[model samples]
Structure formats: C-alpha cells, structure tokens
Target: MGHAICEELEAHGENFIVIDKNESRTETLRDEKFDASVGDISHKDLIEKISMPPTIFVVSSDILANISFTERVRKQYPNVTIFARAADESTKEELVKKGANHVILSQEIVSNVVYDKIKKLEDSADAQKLLRVLKETEEKLAIIVHDNPDPDALASALALKYIGNGVNVESDILYGRGIGHQENRSFVNLLDIELKKIEDTDLNRYNKYAFIDTVPDANNSASVTPNIIIDHHEVTESIPDADFVLIDANCGSTAAIMTKFIRELNVDIPKEIASALLYGIRSDTQDFTRNTSPADLTAAAYLYPHVNYELLKQITSSVISVGTLNVLGDAIKNRKMRGSYLLSNVGFIRDSDTLSQAADYLLRLEGVTTAVVYGIIEDSGIYISARTKDIRVSMGEVLKEAFKDVGSAGGHNGMAAAQIPLGIFDSVKDKDSLIYLCEEAVTKRFLAVVGAEDEK
Candidate 1:
C-alpha cells in the first residue's frame, strides 16, 4: 500500500519521500527512481531531516506499529497530515487519538464497493434499455448539459455523446450560460472537450435533443423542447413528453447513471472520458462524503483504474482566480445568520457561478447547516446559489417555492440556484438601495418558506 501511494504521488509529479526500515524495500524504491530512505520513521533524527507539513501515509498492516508510528510523527512534526490504515472501528478510533489525521478503513471501503457492485448488476438491465433507446434515434443528436454546468453535468453529456457515437448517431454537446467554474474550465480545456453554446446554436438542426443532469422544462436549461431527459435529481416538476426519460433521484450523481450505460454497452471508454466521469462522481458526491449511493461508489471504482490519474490530479488542483476569492471574502464579511442558516450577498460579481463556490465555502462553517450566497451581475440580475446538508428540508424545493414567482429556480435536493431578472428591481437606481431591497426580499421569502424567519 505504501508503494502504491508512492507510485500515485510520483505519477502526479508530486515530490515525495518514502521511508522504510527494511533495506530491501527502500532499495527497490530507489531503483525505481523514487526518493527513499532506509530509516525508522519514528526516529526523531530521521524525521528532522525531512521537510515539514508533508502528508504522511501509514500503510503498515501492523495496527500497533501504525498507532505508535503516528504518535511519534505527531509529536515530532505536530502539523503533518497522516493517513493511517485501520483494521476495524476500534483501531480507527485508536489511530485518530494517536494523531492520524484520517483513518482509511480497508474493510469498510471494500464492503461498500462490494455492495455497490451487486446493485450495479441490477442497474445494468436499465442501461441496456437506455442503449436501445439511443440506437432508436436516427442520425443527429444534441446533448444538453444543465446551465452553468458542473463536472457531473458535463461528464454525463460526454458519456451520452460516446454512446451516440457508437450508434453512428453524430452528436454535439451543448450548454447554456457557458462553463464558469475554474475546475470545470480546466477539465474542459485540458481534455479538449467541445461544447456549443445554446445562443449560437440552432435547435432545429438536431433530430433529437437530450437533457443530461437537468429536468425537462426546468427553467435552467436550453429553451428547446427535449425528446429525452436523463437525470439523477428528484422529479419535482411535471416532465415533458419525451421518447426516452431515465431519472433515478436515488442515484448520487448523473455521471453514475451514465457510467452504467457506458459499461453495460461494453464499449471502449476513452481515457479522458473515464477520468471525466470519475471526477464528475467525486465532485458531485464531495468525494463520497455527501449524498453518495452504492451505484456511485461502483461507478467510481470501475472508472478508477482506467482514469488518467495525472489529469485528474491537475483538474482537481486547478487554481482559483482572484475574482472568486474576492467574492468569497465579501461573502464572509457580509454574511447574515439565522440559527443554522447563513446568507451572504456579494454586492457585485462578474460571474454568477462564483455564488455557488461561496455557498460551498460558507456551508463549512462550524454551526452552519445551510448557506445561500447571491451576487448581482451587471445586466443579468441577481444570481442565487444555495447548498444544504440538512435533509429535513430540501434546498431545491425551498428555492422553487421562494423565488419561483419572480425568478427561475430548481435543482437537486442539496444544491440549487435561482436567477431573478434585474427588471424587477430596476426602479432602485442607488446601488446600495438595490442590494438592500433585493437581499431583504430574497431573505424574507426564503426564510418564510424554510420556516426559519423570526416570528413576530
């Protein structure tokens, strides 16, 4: 396992040093051109020779040895991140107390993967039906990703395009509002993904329109009527009559659903496609920390070995722009709190999608369970992004009820967004007055719907 970690780190061009007491193992690693040392990691002298703040992976099978080594490293470095392997829950707890920053339980991860595979076997039947539907479509097709698309949306679109290409049905991937997330931009630019903007596209040119990761007639996608809808979000609104529709709200990410289709069809998945799908699942599931299902795990495990690890590393580590940081700073300073809820208005933002980024960051606060971040775009009106971990209330449904009368809003249960036209508040010319009115209206409406507003 230590060797595997070293190989992965080296694969991503990350500078790392491997320490082992066994001379043979150290020698083998050195022969493989890796930085290696034959010394006890628990030794203070050896630890002092190394760099500070390094991420240490303790993969020894010996539970006591692992715990002892972690404790020693914690005492010496004090700030190094340690990932220790655990045999069971008790061992995991012990390692944590001994200063393991993260406990990687092999049994738990394996059992989850096994359960996912069993469930995936059942999902394959649906994938075959989906493939037949794709084969039924003749010639040209347009795959529409949700507006301001994320990794899950974009990857699902790519998977559909791959299936379409197999059926000899030429297809083009289209997105409305363009891609704005920095990581998303890197994914597309690095992978050379071709996406046509809806504004420049003619809907009449395609024989079939399929929406991936978005529901039909939801105000968040292309204006064209879709013949097919494949999504993983809860079906809240009435859907359009389409030739094919596959929506499993229980699935963690749309990428998982599309991955099933790709694997079931037994087609060759390009390296970039596999990496994109893997990233999509990880991003949407927050690295399997939230809203993850067995199918999601199975899809991710299946794609893991085939993914371009280097590219995935690069995409995930993409740098954030100064503009996004500024928006986040404003959001932090101006945030309002009501119980577990947090709302922030980032006065003005050039890219509306930055609101989502801010919301994600704010939700990480110690006591916050829900976060809503909004910013005014010059001519685009108020763009609001909401995220919640509280399962008692669905954020998407909340947004739909709050702003549906005056704006367009709807998304998955956990993550949702709304866009209100600037015309409604056009009467207020003063920038501060416009922001205040907008914030007051949105906060009241949202709080009332969520039953979070202060009672009179």
Candidate 2:
C-alpha cells in the first residue's frame, strides 16, 4: 500500500521522499529514480539527521513501529502533519492521541474499495438499462428540461443527449421558457450547446422523450410522458410512469448522477460536457455550501482535470442584466421585516430568475435568517424564491405548505421556489390593486406557514 501510494504521488509529479529499513526496497526505489533513504524511522538519531517536510506519511505494516515513528515525529516537529496507517481501531485511536493528524485503517480502506466496486457494478447496470431504452427509440429522442433551465438542468440534459448519441440515437435538447438567467445564458453560449425551444420545435417528430432534473408533474412545460426520468429533487408526489427512473434526493444535483453514469459507462467526457457538469454541481450546491453530498464532491473531482476553467469562469462571471438590477432594486426597496424574516415584492418582472438572485442577496443582510422574494411575470403567474440560513426551517417544506393548493413548490432545505397561476387576478385591470392583492396573499400565507404571522 505504501509503494502504491508512492507510485500515485510520483504519477502526479509530486515531490516526495521514501524511507525504509529494507536496503533492497530502498535500492529498488532509488533505481526507479525516487528519492529514498534506508533508515530506522523510529530512531531519534536517524530522524534528527534528515530534513522533515511539512507533511509526512507513516505506512509501515508493523503497528508498533508505525506508532513509535509517529510519536517520535510528533515530538520532534509538533506542527508537522502526520498521516499514519493503522491496522485496527485501537491503533488508530492511539495514533491520534500521539498527535497523528490523520490515521487510515487497513480494514476501512479495504471496505471502501469493496463498496466502490459494488457501486460501480450497480451504476453499470443502470447505465445499460438507460442505453436499452434509448436504443428502443425508433426516431430521435427529445430530452426535456424544466422551464427556464438552470445550470444543473441544462448540464444533465446535455449529458443525456451525449449518451443518446453514443447509442446512435439522435436527440434534441428542448426547454420550455426562455433561459432568462444571465449566467445560464452565458453557459449555453460559451459551451455552444444546442437547445431548441419546445414551442418552436415539433415534439411529434420525436419517438421517445426523456426528462432531466425535473419530472412531468413539476413546473416543466412538456405534456408528454417521459420514457426516462432523472432528478435529484425529493419526490413529493407519485412519479409519472416512466421506463427508467433515477431519482436520488441524496444527490445535491442531477448533474452528479449523470457524472456517475458517464464514469461507470467509461464514456470519454468532452471538455465542454465536463466543464458544464462541474459548473452545474457547483451552482446547484451553492459551491458545496448547501445540500451537498459525497457524490457531488466526487463528481466535481472527477471532472476537475477535464474541465475548461476559462469557459467556466466566463459562464459564472456573466454580466447582470438590466432586468435583474431592476428586480434587485425593487426587492431592496420593498423589503418588509418580520423579526429576522425578510420578504420583498418585486411587483412585476419580465424575467422570473431575478427573484432567486434577489432572495439570495437579501439573505446576506445582517440578522436576517430567512429571505423571500416574489414577482409577477405578467401572463404566466407569480414566482417566489426563498433562501434561509436557519437550520430549523426547511425552506422547501415551508413553501410547499404555504402554496400547496395554489401552486407548485419544493426545493432543498436552504433554497426553494414556487409558481402560482394568475387565476382570477389575471382579469384584474387595475395594476396597483392586483399587486396589492398578490402581496397580501403571498406574505400572509408565507408568514403563517413559518409561524411568524404574529411577529412584528
């Protein structure tokens, strides 16, 4: 294991030195062009003679010897990071008490390896099922994303399209509403990703349909039943019938699941696809600060080497549009505080994505534990975006209970969104009265659900 670790470090062009009591092993490492020395690692005289690096690894099979070496190193260099290997739990605890920064157990490492192999087999099976479904497509497959697709939705759609192409099946990436988010638009433009507006495209031409990052009952505009459904959202309702379903609420984003499929299937990820998936994971997880899972981080690490950093930078640093600025201004001006809760009404907006931006911004205010921003989208309806730093409140559940009968709403614990149809308010000719009614209803319901209705 120690030699294997050394090989990995060497493969990554990392500077490392190898020490062993076996002269033959030291000679072999030296012959392989490694910096090596034969010495008793526990001996104080030998340890004092060599220059110690900021980090050291002790991986000898002898548990007593490893413990002795770790204690000696810790006493000599108190601040140095010691990564030591232990054979069991007792040894690990003892090593930690001896000032080892990290201790890896042999049994734990073996168990992890076994678990990964089993997981890979399971992923491979799932990938094959998806391929079979794609192969059954007589004509082109239509990959549908939610309305006004975010980075996670867009990237997952792209990955499915890539998979479809691998099976010699033509696919078109379809979306409902316009991609109004500036950063999302930049992502599509920079990656040269091809997407067709569902309204403009002839949906009848496709023989099969697949939904990514969303389900049919969600806010998506597609009416057709999907053949394949992949999403990371918590399943709040009965999923529509589908040939293949991969819904893992544990994942931070659907992009992470897609990344796993790409890896297990051994598909060579294109630089554009890699970059998109990486950004998608980062965006949906709020840079791994919210609703993140081990799978999400693993996916990001897998794509890091293949990602196009320049394109990712351009996508994230997109210029905020005038509409977004106006919405932000309105949100700030109209913000109402109820204790630590902040709610804002942006009145009417051409782009609903700005609500989320406003909500995110408002959550940064001092002493504010939660922020909710809402805006009307003329003909569509009223859109609400919420953010919360309070762990006691699950924003998704709050929004769902607040608007259960009136609209569709659900999201992670930290962030959530909702859309309510205009209904009778669509006929209101007076704009001010309409805005007042909407504000009153939204604010009251939200506050009531969060148990802040009585708070001033």
Candidate 3:
C-alpha cells in the first residue's frame, strides 16, 4: 500500500522515498519515479536511511503498528507533513494520540476522487457559466443544511461561513432544529454559532447561496440551486449554480478543507472561532490521525494556539438533547447482521449524524469487519452510513450501487453516507421498506464488488 501511494505521488511529480517490508516493490518504483528502500517501516535502521524528508509522508499501513514509525519520522523531521490512515474514526482518534500531522482514512479517499472529478468538470464552459449564475448576487450569501444538524454538518457549515466572511461577503447560515443533540446544544451555548431560520433567509438578500455537507436537490434539502458547494459526501447531480466546487472523497471533514482556504488567505482566526473550527477539524478528521491531509495538520497547528480548550471540552461533553435518545434507540433495536456487518434499522430519525454514530459504534462488535446502519430522519428520506475493514472495496462505490435508483450516493473507501428519497413511492412511503430496500441494494452491490464474503 505504501508503494502504491508512492507510485501515485511519483506520477504527480513528487520526489519521495518508499520503505516497505516487501523489498521488491521498492525496486519496481525505481523504474517509475522516487527513491525506494526495504525493511520494516518500524525499524530504526530503515528510519535512518530515509535522507530526503518528504513534504508529505503518508502513513498508509496499519495504524497501531505505524504509530512509532510516524513518531520517529516526525521527531527526526518535525517540519515534514504526515498523512496517516486509520481503520475507523475511533482508530483514527487513537492515532492522533501519536501526534501525527494529519491522518487520512480510506473513506476519505472517496471524497478526494469526488473533488478531483469536480475539478475536471469545473473547467467545462457550461459548468463555468452555471457557476456565474450563483455569483449574480455579489455581496451576500446564504448557507443551508438539513432539518437537524450533526458535528460534520455543523462544522462543514461553519467552515463555509468563515470562508464567506473572509471574502467580506456576508453569509447568513440558515437552518432550524439546532434544538437536538446535547453536544450540539452545548456547542451552541459555548460558541454561539449564528444561524437564520430558512424561511427568514431571503434569497434576494444574498446574491448566492452555497450548501455545505449537503448536495442540494438530492436529500431533504430545501435549496438545491446552490451557486457554491463545499462538501465531503457523495453526490450524483452537478450543483446547478456553483461557480467553484470543492468536493473530495479523500478528506474526512469539510472543516479539514475549509481550514485550507483560511490558511491560504492568511486570515486571523479569532480564538473562539478557532476553537470551534479546531474542534470541527479534530472531530471530523478524528484529530489529524484519520481522514486527514497535510493541510489539516497545518490548519490544526495554526488553530491550536487560537482555540479555547475549555469551550471545546464543554461542547464535546454536553448533555444529550431532548428526544435524541429515542432516535438512537431505533438504530439499536433494529440492528441485525449480514456476514460480518451489523445491519441496523433506525426506523425514523431526526439527526443524520446520530445514524452515522450508531453505525460507527456497531463496527466495534467482535468478529465484525463491517457495519451498515440505516434510518429515516423524518418524511420519506432514509439516511445510511457504512463502515468496513476491506480497504479495496470503497464504500463510495458500494453506496453508489446501493442507492442508484433509490437516491444519489457516494463515500470514501471505508465509510460512506447516502440518503434515499422515497417520496415518490407512497407504498414504500411510511412503511418499514426503507431498511429492507437498503439491505437488498447494499447486499447485491457488496456481493458484486467482493467476490467472496465471511472469510474472517
């Protein structure tokens, strides 16, 4: 895997050195580009042999085993950037304890792919023209999320707010249901993140509106004519008016990318805002140890001195919001299994992040290599989040297959999220068919991608 990354980087003209257990792979890359060496990445001797300190050092191998390896590299080359990968978000969190500059996950790779594709499409004349439509309004912008909010959604939204604010363009974040999620409530109380009611936000007031962590027209989003978009999730439709789109499958959090823009502009991030933004980066990337980039690390370090630690603690440990438990209960009770996957049915939900959290916890079960959690967050909208150990089978592709006809979908290598709008089919309407359909769709897709199953 390290060789593969080195190979890919070399293709892009990066001068890197590869140290691997399989010595032959190193020689193979000699013909491609970059330098190579053989030996355990954890060995001290191999560490000394790496003379050229790379700007980006990707920890693509096992997390626990690579911790010391990354530490040694960082200790030797403090300025070098480390891009690490974790098996799960929690594992990613654990990796952060090792002081990694940045951690990326397989799931995030999907986000990168999405962004790369968008970068290509954005060059087209038609796409460029549509982006202009979003710019029609020059001074003000409005940003929206789904009905309720989660850390990823909130952080992503806040990131855009900062970006809009940086350009001296007034952006009013419009949404409701900041009511649920204790952590959310605490974050609200501590940071006072501004928001505007969707109804109150006059599209006329803002020249353009951009959506974060959401692809308009696909989910239960009230607005889809977004002129600008910055998201980490998968989407099928091209945002109609977005002049510039930064959607990537490689990044874990939009905050991870949002921080990049903040750095680029050399803007001074307020301490409180830095705290919120840092927490957003920590929470989404699981602290630069998972689903991260060199940019995320740079942003984190830049924001570290500016963050309010006490406020961050308050928000992370805040009391659960009212009715949030009921939403979680539904996710647990309906949980079942398909192969090593714990398939849970969150019948109806209010928060999309809760459904994702439930799926995240389910992956910790013994003998399970993967877990799939699904639920509806009101109306006919069914939301899904998936996790897996198979690094080869990207959940993004899996999600696209599962939600092809049901809805638009995509994700990174290990984790993916999809929302199916069954509003068209009333029979499947209020029925328990959401989970059933999800299971069937996911199963068929999984079987096709992975030839054999249950080997573990």
Instruction: Give each model's clash number.
Output: 0, 0, 25
Clashes of 3: 25
**Tens digits of per-residue lDDT for model 1, 1-456:** 676667666654556777788999889999999888787755657656766544677777777788888888898777566778889999999999999867878764443343334334445656666677678777689898876888999899998888888878788998777677799999899888899988888878887889999875564557777788999887767888887788887788999988888888788889999999999999998999878988899899899988999999999999998988999999999999999999998887888778989999999999999999998887778889999989887888899899878987877778888888899987788999988988998899999999889932
If scored against the real structure, what TM-score would every candidate get? 0.72, 0.75, 0.63
Where model 3 places Cα greater than 4 Å from the true spot, the runs are 1-139, 146-149, 166-168, 175-180, 197-200, 218-224, 233-241, 321-330, 428-456
Predicted model with the maximum TM-score: 2
Report every candidate's CA lDDT.
0.83, 0.88, 0.64
* Lowest lDDT block of 10, candidate 3: 118-127
Per-residue lDDT of model 2, residues 269-346, tens digit only? 999999999999999999999999999999999999999888888998899999899999999999999999999998
Q: Where does candidate 1 have its weakest 10-residue lDDT segment?
A: 110-119
Per-residue lDDT tens digits for candidate 3, residues 1-456, read 455565465554444566667667667766665566666766677766656453444454557766777677777776455666677888778667765655667666643443343233322322333234443557877877655655666766776676555546667777644345567667766777777777555667766777776667544345546777777765655556556666765566667666665655556777776777788778767566556766567767888887888888878777654465665666577766656666776666666767666777777778777777776656646667887776666777777775677686666677777777756445664356755665565555555555435532
Residue 5 C-alpha lDDT in model 3: 60
Off by over 4 Å in 1: 1-125, 219-221
